[model samples]
Target: MIETHSSSLKTDQMFINLGPQHPSTHGVLRLGITLDGEVIVKAEPDVGYLHRGTEKLCEVRGYHHCVVVTDRWDYVSAMTNNLVFCLAAEKLMGLEIPARANYLRVAMCELNRIASHLLFFGTYGIDIGAFTPFLHAFREREMVLDLFEMVCGARMTYNYIRLGGVMADAPPGWADKTSEFLKYFKTKLREYDDLLSFNPIFLDRTKKVGIITAEQALDWGLSGPNLRGSGVSYDVRKTFPYSIYDKLDFKVCVGEAGSCWDRYYVRMREMAESVKIVEQCLAALPSGDIMAKGVAKIPTPLPGEAYAHVEGARGDLGIYLVSDGTSCPYRLHVRAPSYINLAILQEALVGLRVADMIAVLGSIDIVLGEVDR
Candidate 1:
């Protein structure tokens, strides 16, 4: 009483593997994709190629020593990554960072957000065959990196933020230079729109392609530009309001289009809002101690678990740590936004063309470092 079917029941759809090494993928992400001709039918992401047991590694290290490991997870937003970990530890230890330190943290994390988004702008443009935006975005990104370097001494793998406060104060004139860069960044954003945002070819390539509705996005736990593109106004900064975000005034950019263009616009506008926040932090920057007391020693809170998250450039970068009254954490878990965002690629790709698939993936702006680790 069983129904059986032979090869005749199989559809004509064929599976195509997109990158453990492909140009547009931006890193080592392999998609076992099923295609109905040029349209994607299913996409199964094959990850863990870059996993190095970061959580396990953090457990073996001292509480103050895992900052470097956090840096590698979302290297583009390394400061934000460090902030999340530090905040979690701070919360557990009942530490109160100074107003100056809080504002500095906000400013640095905003700068990190801008730089991270610029990288997204660059790579997304590259994926869609617009070579110029990548260069322009990188140019702006370099300025932010320079400012960060002056403050922290390291560029990409910056373990700048630490528990209780930052590693150091902003070097004098850093604010002025940062303000100058912000002005340049605004002008570059306009240039980007003129160059590619509304280009007929770019529009044709993105609009109505790789569409994901608001309901579908929410159902799949999408966040950041991906969720905002579908018209959701949720921002972790507004929702959670940590590190004096409550004191700052900024708008959360959302798009109604639910397409690649909408996602692109959401991020572009977000950069401008971040500029506003940075300018505020710079103008009202308090002059005082950078590092808080009792931070030099490894802190061990009472045995418990706490979760702290930040509105990272990509999405909510959450750190969950468990303490057992020791200098070393009993357990550590990172809720990497890129990893969660990538989970919805199969749904996003279901009816899209191969080229649009790349565009959609690029628009999602994944960092393989975060995804696999």
Candidate 2:
């Protein structure tokens, strides 16, 4: 006779909150999780802890004044934000950016991409209990920030990229310094591989953990490394070819397994690709006016609507602008990639151990500034 044991009876599920203050949440994000034993049954993301209403602010500010506000969206990669906003404004006004300006924009955005990825590498390591990688990654990142400081005087929020052009050309000897940095950074990437990529513990923790299929990624609207890690080869730079990316040559890094390690490795490979792009941009940079001629202080755009997108560190960062033949945008909307990418947390967290939840979320690499904007 078959009989069910009393100990085998179903138990009540436990509900817990993971954030609103937890470091692993990566921002001010709060996650409400339902646990069956140690496994997650349901996960819901509670956001808006850092909301600043940036889109509404854009509508009230003049064209030039709005550029400064974009810096706060994804403060880690502010250059990309500045470039996207400027691109939308330029498109609406029918302005033509000079060749040199385009090259400079590409170089700055690539450098910011490297910086953002390095931060992810370090922070993800800490999330998984490896403190050493954080030091190594940050050491390299400081050098990149120094280069940015040389041009814009601010390390983090560089409001350097402007409408029709950049705020200024590279400082004297900046190109040589950047070339030197690229050389140094390439060697550091190898060290990172040795330290974390193939480490036995790291592999055990990340290799098959948090697996997501390409189809699932698409259904969830993932992009950038998060999508590429799922084996999708779509990249805004390749698909859209904005700025001077078409003029340069680089590979779009993709992963096969769609695990946490795959996402991590994709970012590592992307840093190398970004270095190649920067080297090419510096080599072929042309000389010309940094800003367009005769641009009005608060120039009005023709009545129309335009959307511009660029491959940001997180994903496809897009800006939608509506002009009513006025100096300020009538309406502005920002497509915050981090916010969109965070939606997949609910699917990814189910069936994962509470421990694995941190690894999965870290792989998404979200910044709350963008998520809550």
> Which residue window of length 10 is worst by lDDT in model 2?
3-12
RMSD of 2: 2.0
In terms of lDDT, model 1 sits at 0.89
lDDT of 2 by residue, 74-156 (tens): 99999999999999999999898899999999999999999999999999999999999999999999999999999989998
Clashes of each: 0, 0
Best by lDDT: 2
Q: What is the lDDT of candidate 2?
A: 0.94
The numbered model that scores best in TM-score is 2
What is the per-residue lDDT of model 1 for residues 1-373, given as tens digits with 9 covering 90 to 100?
9998685565688988988998888789999999886878889989998999999999988888988899999888899999999999888888889989999999999999999999988888889998998888888888899999999998898898888888889888988899998888888889988988888999998887777799988898888888999899999999998889999999999999789889988998999999999999989998888888876476767999999998998888899999998888899999999999999987888877888888898999899999988
Query: Against the true structure, what is each candidate's TM-score?
Result: 0.96, 0.98
